[model samples]
Target: MAHLIFSEDEQRELREAARAEFPGNPALAYVLENLAAEGIDLDRGRDWEDLRVEAGLPERNAEAPEVA
Candidate 1:
């Protein structure tokens, strides 16, 4: 599976779109379901980096320059 990384602006836009399309905890339901399917329990207290690594997703490098 190819993972597409999004910049902050793109992420914000996508989130706003989701909210407009589906009201009331729209993304939360999907996120929780997928995480459960992946055997990721939020109660385990996993950090953001841990979640990304577990999900086989890429993490943005803070020191790296953004591609234009």
Candidate 2:
């Protein structure tokens, strides 16, 4: 296994990207665990959406957006 280095800004970007991909708490937790194994700490509280908003990432809707 190889060690990877990420800057602060890069870490922030990675967190946001992960949040965008895994909107649900369970899915997000899975992602965090994988990241932790890689030595990157990206854990969120119980409420996943709340964490996303706190991180300045856009909130994900439970339902799909209505098409015009």
Candidate 3:
């Protein structure tokens, strides 16, 4: 298995981008999930929460639409 690591700056950027391009194209999210399961680097180490911070991805509320 592999590991994923990311910096603060990278985290922030990823979150922004994700939210900016929300609806995340389910396909894209699926790809990331697949990569993660395989121990691959998806979003360059920026996982769900970090992806939001890095890509500026909107906060995903279980009761709301996912902006990633």
Candidate 4:
């Protein structure tokens, strides 16, 4: 089992980024659920947008579409 944590700043950034990138809340929640089930715990916090990417979900850049 593993653990996940994030600083306040990281949490804020990921939260905002997810809101901007994901089309809706369900999408974001889905990613979070999967991560949690995978032993990824948001102790202090977590980088949800990054986790979304790890979960093979779409992600957006800060100023543009994601670059592969």
Best by lDDT: 2
Which residue ranges in model 4 land beyond 4 Å of their true spot? 29-39, 42-68
Query: Candidate 2 residues 8-68, lDDT tens each?
Result: 6766677777766777776775676456445533342247677767899765566857545
lDDT of 4 by residue, 1-68 (tens): 34775666666666666656765676885575454344355464658787887899756658766557
TM-score of each: 0.34, 0.37, 0.33, 0.37
lDDT of 3 by residue, 2-65 (tens): 4665455665555555545656486675554444344444445545686669888677678896
* Range of the 10 consecutive residues with the lowest summed lDDT in candidate 3: 32-41
Count of backbone collisions in candidate 3: 18
Residue 67 miss distance in model 3 (angstroms) = 23
Error of 4 at 58 (Å): 26
| Residues 3-62 of candidate 1: C-alpha lDDT, one tens digit per residue | 345555665665566556657886675664443334434455658788879999777889
- Model 1 global lDDT (CA atoms, 0 to 1): 0.60
Candidates in order: C-alpha RMSD to true structure: 13.4, 13.5, 13.5, 11.0
The Cα local distance difference test for each model comes to: 0.60, 0.62, 0.56, 0.62
The 10-residue segment of model 4 with minimum total lDDT is: 33-42
Question: Residue 46, candidate 1: how far off, in angstroms?
Answer: 25
For the record, the alpha-carbon RMSD of candidate 3 to the native fold, in angstroms, is: 13.5
With a 3 Å backbone cut-off (N, CA, C), the pairs that clash in candidate 2 are: none
